[model samples]
Target: MKLRIKEVIKEQGLTVQEVATRIGKSKQSLHGIIEKGNPTIGTLSDIAKAINVPIYRLYEDDNDLSDSPVIICPNCQTQIPIETSIKIKSYNHD
Candidate 1:
């Protein structure tokens, strides 16, 4: 699931360093969570607080499927099969 941290940060006009400082984490650590999608619960909670958004906003409902497929590594411009694209790591490896 996408964390939507970047979106919130942009919407709020908050720099990564600003949020990181507010949440008591290094800027690099917060960037890793946003780009790499592996933040601990505590980190996520802090992010939620920083953004003034609920934790659930970071997670998409499994039953709510979007019609469009999400493509990664668009260098190939390949239409990745959504049903088979199990994880972000798989997409990154493509």
Candidate 2:
């Protein structure tokens, strides 16, 4: 799953080095986090703080999905569609 961080970084118009400095990490370290693609929530929180955005923005939104309910993988940023089927069981007890 991907965090879509690269896109956010680009949108923010801030270079990786700039963010790394704000987050107290090195550019290499920040790149490693993106390369790993499996950052912890705390890590994400830190990034959000550095980028001055809500953590949720790091994930994909409705614009990224189609007819199905889709969730983005934090490590790979792939959209996974969820089944929207309902199952109901009717039982009679006398």
RMSD for each model, in Å, please?
Answer: 14.6, 7.6
Model 1: CA > 4 A from native: 60-94
For model 1, residues 13-92, the per-residue Cα lDDT tens digits are 88999999999889998888888986777677788798886555554434332454443322432334356555554345
Tell me the number of clashing residue pairs for each predicted model. Answer: 0, 7
Q: Candidate 2, which ten residues in sequence have the lowest lDDT sum?
A: 60-69
Minimum summed lDDT over a 10-residue window in model 1 is located at 70-79
**Residue-wise C-alpha lDDT for candidate 2, range 4-85, written one tens digit per residue:** 7767887889888998898899999999998887788778888888888766667655465433456555576566667777
Name the top lDDT candidate.
2
- Where model 2 places Cα greater than 4 Å from the true spot, the runs are 62-94
